[model samples]
Target chain A: MNLLEIDTKKYIPKILEAVIETWGEEYRYILVEKANKIKNINYIDERGILHYHRFLENCIQKYLSLKFLEEIGVDTSQDDKNLGLPLDSNTKEQMNQYFGNRCIFSPDFWKDAKGIFAFDKEVIEDFRKTSVEEGQIEFLNPLRGNSEITISNYEQFKQTKEYSKLLKQIHHYLDIYKKLDHEMKKYNKKIQKYSDYVDSEDKRKERILDLKRCELYQEIESELPESLRKYLDLKYQTLEQKLRFLFPELDEKSYIEFFSKKDEDNLETETCNVYALRLCYLRRVGIHNNLNIYDNSKEKYEECLKQPGTQEFIPSFELVDKITRTREKKYEEGIKEFIFTSQTFLENFGQMDNLEETKEYVYNLILNRTKVANIPLADEKNNYPAIFFPIRPSYNGILDLAYIHEFIHALLYFSLYDNRWGSGFDICDDDPALLNPYRLNKRKYERLNETITDIYAVKVKNILHKKGIYLFEPKELVNEDNSAWNNTSLIVRKMLNPFLEKFHHEVILSLVTANYSILLDKVGSENFEELNDCINKVDYLIDCGLNLENPEHKPELIIEYKKEMSRLEKIYHNMDNRIQVVTEAHK
Target chain B: MDIRRIIFIKKSPFRMEYLFLLQLNGNENMIRFTGLESRTDKESINSKVVNDTIVTNFLEHFFRIVSNWNDTYINKNTLDATTWNIVIEYKNGKQKEYQGVDSYPINFDSLERLIDKTIKEIGGD
Candidate 1:
């Protein structure tokens, strides 16, 4: 095939037209309007195409940066640098002093804008050096407030006269929150004390509950101060008022419903999450929280230091969904399936001891990978359960195949972790006998497991294909012609392939939980080879059962095979006992 | 510049594998870690003294990269399945271990390139 080359410059306007069509006429208008407003710009570079690309990048960066800043009352129209995206060393130093290393805008927001949005190279390098010299910057995403808090409102707060009143109000609310927090802790402790007194597990729970129903609890509740009760009532009322004021589109009932669902969804341990969630609510209403107020208010500066992301609101759900849908769509389905399959495999084949926590960890690990670009493909040494393939054209064809394959590897890794004896790594280092098994357990490392993975991948495809859910093109199995099949057949034909038999597969799966090195150490590889030879001879004799030429030889081979089976069973018995001892000792 | 030992083990899902352990304590020594191929039912472990400039230069750059690595991004999810565990034991009994898992320590790709180049130069592959 002959490849045709085209000039990139010729397609620039066409590409722009397509982008404008998809993004809408409004976006194009904004780009042109913003570009015209800028002063002293050189358009011609070495190539006009390069200049056009840079021009587009600059226009998008400036427009998005300015628009986002306007949301926080930065008034980019007055001071463009007020957004704190320093493109030069001079601007960066000024920003450092103003924001103290905290970016005025959230990284997520910039990430959304895209296209050369980060600080210039020199500025970034300077910041890196400073960070290394001092300590890492605690990057905070500046939170915005409701629509009422505009540029004028921020200016009023900065003047110190009007700010004092707002500071007092914030302190009053914080004091009530702290008191309520303490009371909740005290009540929980008292309930725990009462529950511990009863001997019977059932009676302990009943007595505690019954106690709560009695007048003693009422007396304790009544002992609370009237002022504190009034304050608590007022706090909830104020929060509801704030929510209604911010989201004016919603009525009182709708606000209540929103808060109920949102609060239930975010019952987090970290205090910062609450602050960020509240800030998120306020920011959506077009207000700037002006985090500098925390430092300037002089009332709760110390307290504010404890909670991070004071300046930053959590990324909006819409933004998060947009990212996942666009950039992460390639591997998202496969990843979700991979996680589901891994959990299913572990539950069915794993040791099932302390698997609940392990399952949660594995799920979170895979979920976190989906959020970031640096998805770990493989870590056999560290025994990570799953890996993600990079998004490349060469790998696209085999991604589904590899996903299931890696999921099986993860199952194998976790099954070893679930073992009572110890995790695979633990046994490798701690067990004296198992120390050499890493070198000896050559079958897994030798790509035999890969061949098995290939079989399992096909099996998974077949299962999905039956449900009309084809993940990938299923490999055609021509047993006579395939190398994978030939490799699998050799292993199966040589050693009485346990996987072929249901009960034997169960036993083999169980054995995987035990230390492979220890199992091999006890059974002795010599015995395995001998067993392999014996199984082959027995299989040959069975094949000869129908051979009229070897009628007498079949019985003789059967007798010899039975003796070899007895020897194999004895070896397995010894190995199992030793494994049980190790399991018990670890337990 | 006092290097102790370097062990490189390449494992695959297939049967063929290799283990190369190089020691540079006073007298340089190299060990070929082979599997259970010995006649007496034991793994054959042999040690030799071999001087190779490529290995020495590779070690220098490996340590340099490790020392300058920004490990702030090291997290539970940022792990690679295939990893190289480099443990460099010094003369002062201080051991510095670096693991390259999915280009972790951020400079693993460069280190891999260096090692690959050295292997090719020395005809070790």
Candidate 2:
């Protein structure tokens, strides 16, 4: 017969005594959680420190000790009776293996915390003292006689009945309930009183405030023209959230008014690209759908060409918008001069080709030999690579260049320790928020991607110019050259203002308190500054916009940025791939 | 990318809607909102068959911002270079490069302020 099958009629007294002694003082709190039978307050905060409740810990310890002592099964203990504990094979094995018939468990122990000891001092000391040569110390523990007590006998023995008084005493706590109903009735009377005063002098002031709130909501609900208001409000709340990012201090009422009014005012000029590339990418990756995305995007694409210098390039946007801007000439003239100059410069440098396809790709995204704007770049979760031009015209040049850069980004992404989602090609889904460009992750990734792109754009522009492409002219791609890229680090640092407002108070604190690592991924040593700037300032972030756009000091973005930056920094340092090598090299 | 050039300019309860933003690579890296002026109504909203230079010019203006980074030679050594301009070409054959006279070289910190100004002016008084 199993040990649990033993007749509890004999040894229960000893078992009960062991429980009482072992429990010491902590019987109330643990049982409180199991109070379905008792029905106490569920109103107490679920978030209070659980382990600190000594009463609860004691109850659990009592339960565990009773079971542990019963399993050890001492001398007929009091009347040929044997206390039995239902120890499954595994628990029995654990008991027999290291415990050697003597084990004292505190019930407060947690496991598997590494070289980092997370267990209490008693548990640690027990583990240390019980090992090998010191195993005899386990027998010397104060609990050595724990199994000798009999719980059943204690319950029946008149001499030990005094010990059960506390159990009865606990029931008296129910006395409070006698008046609880009366108190609740009193509460109802007060509520009635409050109702009676609803129209009184002081109540009128309160009613006025409530009326104001209602008026505000009604105004928000019915403020603008129907169709236009609906469209604008929906966009403001759902798609466009710039107002929220810009004015985090604005109250809910102010926000509705600000955005609704801004919408009313700008709805006349409102031109959101209903067709987003992110939606397109998500669909292609099989994570989402955009039904008529191609049709929609194609329209926007055509509209783009009607602007200028986009020429016939239709695949890449960055090449047209960003890459070619570093040159000296207007786009048309610049491309021509670049082809002519690089043809000579590369020849002079002993290379054998002209930058023809490169020029075509450059002319594809942007049209000028000047500065760029609103360039589109993409980063993904899984390796589900998107065909991003980053700007316009998606030429072989940009297709090639951004491809390598994106590939590097993809590699760094994989090295991430805290991936909130999946790992391969389709790591990212179409972000509903990407279209707004203010999402935390989206903004960070875009800035990181673009700053790196700027590096190449400046590099490519310089090499082309060094080859005598200046036959057209030279544009400053560097800040020293009087360029925005020249001082962007400082601007991105300033953009970090809003991060400060949200740190200790909300978002980050919630994550940290829950022990979820949101930004603890492996970032480069160089990027530590960007990380600190971004994080330390989270408390004040609402006061500022989401981006680090304050305090004109240039921050080392590579340092403060969080990610698998070490690997990326290595790639950034060792990379020698050009647009051609990158695009063509990747199958 | 892979854009189509057909657009519908505002006419009779309908106007060409262009998405605009301030680009960082412009001469002052000014935040400017320029979009494709509607050309023709060829499935205007969602077609990618942009086969014209006029629409292409609008996009090129964006690149022009990039090109102007070092090409600050416009009207150099003269009073003309002192002012800035915005070039606008209508599919109707009306070409105008308005002297931005009142607004130009907006400080980097205040670019959004400029956009607010432009968006405000464009919206109305």
Candidate 3:
């Protein structure tokens, strides 16, 4: 098949038209209305500021303006610099006087219309030289109304369901917008390749038309509602404004160029993830919480961080964004609850031997990637017993299927043997040592423990489907081998005779957990009767098994048990083969 | 009442820099930060003052220390000055040892004074 040789520019407008159409007319109207609202707000606010010049004219503000003016000694009329950001002269002067001999350059500062200032390039260079901190400008007072005090109307407005729902919708659209932006960047390079080409006049016309139609940014904008559009712009501006003032000489072009110089332009590569993206782009990754590890075991994770985006691809991200707790006077004591609950969980349930060590560990809390991402994935690292949760972090359903079945195996491991031992056998292993011997120790109530877990996992799938989360359930199995046939074949399979006899005896001693159809009301009769008989009949066999513990080296209970377990192994092997024959015939 | 800034320095082994921060208490509640990776090849500077000039003296002195140390560590190869950057964290009133660099604008003394002034101006918190 021949690939189309058409330039990428040609497909731009058509895709954009389809995009705008999907968003519907409401989106376009929202933008237009928002533009008008912004125009009106700026005009009204400007008039209000002019009218409110009385406040800044007062002695205190006037004193600041005067002192600041005197310190800088730069008149407003002077425009020697083509592009110098407004600076805060007083702060610069104080810093300069303090660190004079060690100064990198003369501190220059300017404030914009909102009274936010940027230091001179020289001042910033000095700042960088002295310290590597993202220089902050904490206002002694609030710019808007007191951020601490709640506004009555605004407080009430937030309580409305519509407001809450809109916030959720805004987040959803933001997700879509991020995906679109990431995908469109790939096409930009392809379109630029034809810049020096000797294209015909018709081709040039087509290319220009394509460029107009393909405006990716506009389509993303149209998807947002009026209020949300304004909100996003406000947030974008807040970050941009803060960075510009903080860095002083960071013009948008220079900022973009700085990122462009990087191999992956990782500094400028914005991701849909707000916390990760903002921290990464603005050179404040540490502020998002340290995700670095110092352990030898986690060395693989360290190498991945150096590459552009290894963390995002790796399924289990070891993130550290757990909530913090505070002794506060607010509604939900903030991170305070998070801190307390995590600490409490660590103290009460954690597998810690020393109190001091546990406390220290609890203090340095980190969030699991799956939890932080709010992916349906539950963490099983601590090996904590848990009920079935429907989904996991990624959409990949394989682990969910595998683990869901394994968890039931976990229940058996816990019940049959003590849990003080490390984990059970890896169920995926092909070794016959584990599989051959599993049948002899089975309780008559439910001999096929592994199969039982599978059956329950299927039941869980059905239960979840009722809640709208669909999971594939395997069909019910019907073993064709009858008890009489097993009795007759037991003599023929002489090599597995001892193992088979042991299994049959155990089964006879064990009471059944389930009846032929269903045993909903006979729980006591079915489960207890079977278990009691097994204990009653396997008295000497259990003694021999338990004695294996102390024979040579109190060779751990599991190691000792393995020797005796091989007897049952032969019996289980015969059963597997016979059952396999029956199941194969049905298939 | 005082406000102090902390910067965590991972010396020697990993040599990766991280800043574990916290506010320090005044009057002798010192958080002993032991177990820093390395203790070799370090130069220490110490100073004290009574008057307000202490701020200027502290900054100037630390700047000199860093300048001297930067030359010693990065440029000079005769001696191993791998521990180039020095943290000037304020703990209690007393600076640690010759190892502690006097850099930050407000040490315990100045920070306490600043706090007192602020309290008095705020009408006694």
Candidate 4:
């Protein structure tokens, strides 16, 4: 039966029942909610129909495919039936032959990563110990034990669940090893190619140097004796080796100028262009290796952590308004400058033939930029391939941080690592209490990029201050009317200010190459817990201070901040823990 | 008593379009608000019965925050910006409407809550 043609109203119930049986109530709830949402939409509309079709096509199909592929060891790519295409008799026979008498192993254990060992040390050791010549070693399942101790036999092994689980691990490990090997080979080839290019470049430079030397000799030929000039030509093959061939009567300034001109010619702006071209190649191929590693890490996180959600969050009105205004002001003042800067940036960095086309492309960006909450944005729709910011945030006192912060985001995107500083898991998904004491839904860890950018901005601000350009003064207390909650904002800002003031330069310097995920992971999970604890504790202190009846209590809290250095010490120590360490223990 | 005055501005970086739907009880006049300074009489596009429960819930939510609404919330640098300013007149001649971003009073979280509830009760567009 055609999957799309199946009446969803009739089949959804059956699918929900199966999902509930296998994955439990949570999965069923999610599935039902999704299904009902789609069913309500008028599918007569083309877009509506497409959405409905996609929902049915992708929903539960991945799991079902994995099950089928595992049961029949036959390659699905070779069979039309497996691909949901019209069946052929020869392929059908091949499929039957493949399935017949063969063990239909439980693929879910491997595919879903439900198996006990995820690259377990003991399992790996056992596998390594056994050879094809020595025969297979007896392996025990971590979840289950052998009631009757059994040795390895291909047919007999299929009867035990452990065998299939082991096979799954083997398959996974083999795939990873293969991928790693392929990458290593590719890197070797790149290194070799680079070396060859460098060698040819050096040879070319030698030829150029010889030609320049001959030209220089001719320029000063009249100043030299005929015998001396002939002897000078025979003395040197390369210009750089010696300078004794120069005429004593020739002006030293002229000789120096000539050599400097040659250097200037060699180090043209085109040198940067050559490097940029190399960077483009490295970004496509070499950077892809890093991306794979990043993907693997992300997959591991997905397996371990809950899928982040923002359903519980209602965005803060005050914060949203401020952010909106910040962006709006940026667009108002920065649009013209942004265009000029973008044109210059593209001409310098981007390889292009037509200047007019580049301007037109940029002009379209200005015209087509998306607006959200009165803030001009270049989000999903009308998104340019390159980092094209038509509007930049205007620099206010601390708002300059937004300018530098956004610029960094653009820089990171084009960067080889594609260091996504602005992109992260929805902070609203996390518990409100885990972040800043003032704002309930502030995302500190997930918004690591913003923090880093803020740190960088502070560093830049300090340098500018030293040069007599005072951007803005750091306030000890928050402006009551400006914030949603006055006291909370004041306390939190004061608490964070010291760290930003003291460690700004050092922290920014350290994080030049590190991406958002790397920075967070390296910072250690303990620091995050400590941060959460500190925020909670500070909140407690602030609440105590805010008691209207107890006038002395507020004074006491301020005194405590000055006197009680213990909390600050712990927090500072926590902040110091950005270095990565090997510590997690395996069971 | 019907929708007395309806003004909405859909502004993006690319384009800005304004729509106003106004109705009078006896005269039976309809006008489409084009710009801040311009209006066109779109006589064919007259008011319909917007007495549905979902619409009522939206109106109620808007009225709750009417007092807090800012008179002039102008922003020139926003992209994909949407604002709706709706005014409804009752039989007693009392009028209430919301004025906020994205065609709803987003400043008041209650509007979103109400909308979500409405969607759950009766499926949304």
Candidate 5:
């Protein structure tokens, strides 16, 4: 037999019988009596058909309510009135106790009944053909939009024209409600004031009539068209139900407040794109909080809404300002601390000497037997590959540091050529190939290279100081350039501190020689990729900070940078923890 | 004749300096000069004993190259190129040395390949 072709109307009585049996024999008599009353109604005329359908719907609702109460251990046999009444606090508490965290009222319970009892399109069309009123078929089927909107369907639904039209219609109805509410308040105020002053009954009655005749009173008393009114009511009811489900803690008063304010503040100004994105954000918040939307209070929902990314439906100028100020302060303090520490290292272990001697000393220390010409160009700007120093008559600590920095770059460049241990290692400007060898994109490579060079310069200074060859006092290097250099290097150093602690020189050598597989082998591929991501983020943040004066410094860049930094910190923390665990195991 | 020690050094202005020293002191004692030190001020040089098979294989190839090579090969026109020096010391206090600048004998490529292979086999790469 074809199930779809089966006449569902024939099974209604049998299904009702089964439902009544599940509620126990004590309530079976009452439910049967109600079903008989609904069946006995004359469903011939248009009005009678509507009446019959409503009665049957009410009967089913009562049966479901009683079944729920029975399952929750509520005594529904004593009174029939208890069937459809709202579950009180005591009943709700009992239900919670029985169900624990499990969802007791999900739509899945109705799945089989929905399949068996639902009238197919052909049956509904047949009914319409035979029915005296088309409206009667609507009562049986309701409207299409009454279906629930879930996270899965939300993205597709929001793209439909129906969604946009519905939002606009909702906004229009809300505007009407707002105006009517204002006028009603005025009417009530006039009635109250008149009653306070008027002593005579006839005079008081006359004044009330006069107020009723006024425009405000008439407007307050005016009714919406029945069809429009019904549509709005259905939409509003669905929205309220969804709100309650999403935020279970929301009470009636708070939902009313949220609904009204949402209409006024958001829908009034929101475009379709903004509204869709906001819904996406809300869905994310729902998933993150993991609250049973049916059980939570309004306060919990509000708190979830206030979480960092979803605090506002859209990014506001105020949020951008707050993030900027916080980042600026953090970077300022961070750079200062880094500069101080590097300078302290220099002071404790570094030697003071002239630039000429320091140049020779740093080159010999880093390059050893490989000697390249150490040229101090007359130009003030430095270049790479061929190490160029800005020749100044009186060299300060900053100049000496810059010379060391550039010289390291030159050394690393020369050392990496044809010196890699493995085949298929080639230097290229393309990002994919660069990333293949080192797990670093071009930007990451450049940033890491700069940071490594700066750190090596500081280390070289310390080595020189140990050799009793001091170049300049730490005070001379106390400038912006020094702080900037230290800031970047310090971030990278801190990120790689665990590996550096184990293989300090090897780490530097691997980076310099572009033998990154050595490091990748030590730290697994996952950690290597994470390190690459961290370097990329740091590079992006630095670039954004440098371009703060440029018009391209957008709020999105700052937000992205902030998010990346937090993620990088999390990954680094995980890596550190894993390494510690391994180390401890070895011990 | 039993070889007591072997020393190899290669330097270039545009490349990393390579230095290797091996001493047969009852074991194949291999020492590598890294040309860079740790932050803790540890010596840049590291020494370890490689297996006899690796040393024997390396020397078997090394001796063949030395037999065909001259005492010195120099390309005076190429002033700023690589310079390589190799010295073999025997147990009897006699030494054989070979030096080159920007030039090498016909078997030089094979010798370089053998050295590279031996370095990796000994975990120097």
Candidate 6:
């Protein structure tokens, strides 16, 4: 009986029909249709016979495997094993390996294999209960498709849609796990590389210090919450302390000296005098809110006095005559215009009782006519002599006083306009040293000049009042603290009272013309020098008193200032007494 | 080349002298020294740790104005004024020197004020 010549197609149908009776109609298609296709024997050759034999053998093996799995209560239609199988351990192990190696049915047939195999219902229920207790069977699974599955109900759980969906989910999770593992491996490799690079203790310490110095770490720390950031800060500070202990040369205090020594080595050729010039420039131009101008003024005076040829006196008579003539012309024109064009003056032309009505008119005329010019000195072209009116013209009285005071300054500069003698020094606009007592040269006289200006201003006011042009009241310029005129008025009046009373115009002329030699000749050189020294001492006393009044000074400094002030006051008192005696002798 | 230190000196004919020194320690800190140019007497010299940013700003401005200045400046008009000198030392052991008397650059006042502001920040008068 040759198997190939046995008419396999006719016998295969019979075998498939018998198999369907045993394993239900679900296996009908695989056994009948698939077996018929495999038995397509063209000629009865050796190769054809071999092929037919192999096909029959494979069909027999699949049938036996499925029948054995069903008898043992294993899921033949799905990949899952039926734990309800009442079999020995050796047989279970053999069946597990057999099922794992091959599928008994095609994948399309396996989809409908559930409920086709027959099993003991009670054993399946028992297995289902055990699976539930062991958390193996999912009764209310949240996955898609079948919400619940039990061993007693289905013979193949894996052939269900829910199992396929679960398989896909597992694959998705595994892919994600693989990606995470790869990233972890990469990070570990980077860490190892860095560790290998900074292997030595010294190199590690240097790397740590460099990271601490970097701004990137600070930026990252700033983003963290306050508590965590503070904790990290403490940790870093402790680490830095340890690092500093390891490196003794990085001590903060000694670092300054080290750096300074290095700088000194680099600057060995530099001298101190060059730095002094730079310092002087910085002092001159720097905007210091708390500048001690008194100390600076004293320094400037000392510097000026030390220079041999700083105090040369040379007066130009021609320049003086030119200034006087111009002043006379402007004064005449201003007075004429005031009398002729002023409405107040027109209404009360010569009425002495109505002088108050013409005060504003006279003030306007003086303010309008006062020519404030920037006259450059002969030598220093960049230096311009500017007369500053430090007072506000809020009232007619103040306006008149400021006008006359500035007029006197203008007259002084007018003489300097064409004179070569007034060329050495710069007439700085806001110079505190230009205030009083210190006379650097003929062009810079603060004490005598201010005294003369104040006296002349008052005299002009009185003269204008007598002439029925009341520009300001007599007592308007009498401020005890602020008025430079009032401060110097007493000493100047006492010292020059006799001479002023005798030759008031000549004294005024000589002072304004920068002709101090004329006054020296008149007063005698020794007495002139003494008087000048006395004036300087009075200014020194005033300045010392001002310094003593300042509350910002330290108590010890205040004590010293008081002592100096008292000494100056005594000296000034003696000088005043001597000057009075000299005036009396002159009188 | 990286600048390591800068020293500015000024001497007046009236016997007054001053020194302004700025030094960089590594890359983090700057040391400033200002006083009467008495290197031996440390008490006369005021030394303080200043911010590196301040020194950097000063150096930036210094370089800008440095181009306008010559290696030597002499004022023929006045012989009694102050004399100024500056030395810029680099990390490569090279240096640049400049000196002036009375005469100065066009924006020298700006440089003076910048140095004054920088030193003042570190408590220099």
Question: Order of all candidates by TM-score, from best down to worst?
Answer: 6, 1, 4, 5, 2, 3
Per-candidate local distance difference test:
0.35, 0.28, 0.27, 0.34, 0.41, 0.40
Distance from true position, residue A327, model 1, in Å? 28
DockQ winner: 4
Per-residue error (Å), model 6, residue A321: 52
TM-score (all chains, Cα) for each model: 0.25, 0.18, 0.17, 0.24, 0.24, 0.25
* All candidates in order of lDDT, best leading: 5, 6, 1, 4, 2, 3
lDDT of 6 by residue, A265-287 (tens): 43334322222222222232222
Tell me what fraction of the real C-alpha contacts between chains A and B each candidate also makes: 0.00, 0.00, 0.00, 0.11, 0.00, 0.00
Model 2, A445-479: lDDT tens digits are: 33333333334334444443454432111122111
Residue A198 displacement in candidate 3 (angstroms): 53
Docking class of 4: incorrect
In model 6, how large is the Cα lDDT of residue B80? 24
Which stretches of model 5 miss by more than 4 angstroms?
A1-386, A390-397, A413-432, A435-444, A462-468, A472-481, A484-499, A502-506, A509-514, A546-558, A574-587, B1-125
TM-score of chain B of each: 0.59, 0.20, 0.24, 0.39, 0.82, 0.81
- List A-chain TM-scores for all predictions: 0.21, 0.18, 0.18, 0.24, 0.27, 0.26
Better of 3 and 4 by DockQ: 4
CAPRI tier for the interface of model 5: incorrect
Specify the poorest-scoring 10-residue window by lDDT in model 6 chain A: A249-258
Poorest 10 consecutive residues of model 1 chain A by lDDT?
A38-47
Q: Put down candidate 5 lDDT per residue, B21-109, tens digits, no spaces.
A: 87777644565643211111122465667876676556544653454357897643211235789988866676778987556653454
What digit string (tens of lDDT, one per residue) describes model 1 on residues B50-78? 55555445554454344333433323222
DockQ of each: 0.02, 0.02, 0.02, 0.04, 0.01, 0.03
